[model samples]
Target: MTDLKFGGYQGDKSVHTRGGRVLAEALAKETDGALTLAFDESIVSRGHKAADLLSMTESGELDGCYFSSSYLAKRVPELGLFDQHFAVPDRRRAYVLLDGTLGYRLREEVAKATGYEVLGYWDNGLRHITSAVSIKSLADCDGLKLRTLANEDHQRVFRALGFDPQAIDVRDLPEAVKTGRVDAQENPLTNTLNFGIHETHRHILLTRHLLGVALVLFNAERLATLDPDQRAGLQRAVDHATQAQRRFAEGDDAICSTELTAQGVEITELDADTRAAFVAAAKPEVEITRQNFSAELRDLFDKELSAA
Candidate 1:
């Protein structure tokens, strides 16, 4: 039996990490126990940092890893750009993009760009802003150092809105806030709850920044070396994990607003006018990404999403 060393973020055993657990169990069953998974160590703890996890996987030092869009973008720039447009403010449309044409096209682009495969697309739900203060308009971002990940899209969006985006690593966020290195951050409600960010921040601006995230990944030649049956088993495992994680993320996202409120994290709902201002600031970046991708592919994605 071959043991697969799976690594994940230490986010309170949330659905994201638990999804990996499901994958391992599924693979264990499908492989008739030939493949087992063990995960305790994280790529973050190994000096690769969150942004470098996928690159470590490519180097064959790590067997498998789960990453947010920001973390995955370290090695794949175009996919990171996808994080911007993929966030169309509609959770259902975001789901349409993933699982539909958006998922397939972006996966192909990632594979071609990184020389790796996108094993599966899973939901992370939507993202919201956690600030110490309220945000009523785009101007509210001025001079605010918002903590974002290494995601180009996130930085670009904040930049477009005229703010100083502090690209902080996830692990360092708590200290960054305490030290006043950043004023706010954009993260999912699940993350706020799981990572205890809600304890530090007071405002959660509902932006629904993309439908959570779709993981772009592969472990270099590992999957390529698997026999056909092994490959199918592994694929099934990834898919099953995706399904479980999506369900978990969706429910958690719904509960997040209430959960945060209970924790004293004020939920700030942007009115239509203010939301329109944000859309105005962000839409150009989305259109610019259109040229970065193929028109045919983008159009195909639109069709698939519409069909849904």
Candidate 2:
């Protein structure tokens, strides 16, 4: 029997960890116990940062992990295609593009450029802003210290939207929010609540500026050493987990919102005019960032986006 290790940064109850658990069970069943998986659901509990999962998996310290695509944009610029603000309008459209040709091409690129093989794309959720104070317009963002992923494109778009963007790792965010190190942060309601960000940040602004996706990654060299049947079993496990994870993510927004409101968190939905103003304010930065992507990648994204 082959025993594999999987790691994630979120708590055991989070969608990411739940998906990892699913993968482990499915892999064992598919392989008829020829393969087994042990999941370390929260590596942060062991004193590792969330961003460290990428290198850990690359170095084979972990057999696999699910990490946000934004973290790899610098290494695989094609992934920055997903980093574009307002490009993915909603969860349905985001999945259409990700489950289609665009996702296949990007997966190939990631394998070619890095030490990992992409197994599946999990919905990271549609992100929204949670602030210490109310934010209803673009002006409300001016000079506010906003915490964002460590992606240049994300930082650029937030900066253009009048925010003072700072990149903070997931492990440090709760303390940062509590200590007022950041005036605001953006995440899906699931993450905001699960990470305890909502406890400190009283206002939840429905910005929906970006739809996030996490890549299910396995060490490429280790994967190559697996027999054909083992590889097929692993793929099947990932597929099953991906579908289940998306379903959990889809329903979690409403559940999280209800729980937040019960806890007295102020939920603000942006009116049409306010949302449009944000889109308009972010347009120039989006265009400028797109110019930096390879023409082939941009063309692929454009074709896929239109079809979506």
TM-score computed on alpha carbons, candidate 2: 0.98
TM-score of 1: 0.90
Task: Write the residue-wise lDDT of candidate 2 on 1-308 in tens digits.
Answer: 99988999999669888888889999999999998899989899999999899999999999999999999888888888878887777788778888898889889989989999999999999999999999988999999999999988899899988999999999999999999999999999999999999888999998888889999999999998899999999999999999999999988988999999999999999999998999998899889878877898799888877888
List the candidates' TM-scores in order.
Answer: 0.90, 0.98
Query: Ten consecutive residues with minimal summed lDDT in candidate 2?
Result: 86-95
The best candidate in terms of TM-score: 2
- Stretches of candidate 1 exceeding 4 Å from the true structure: 45-48, 70-81, 85-89
- Which residue runs of candidate 2 sit more than 4 Å off their true CA positions? none
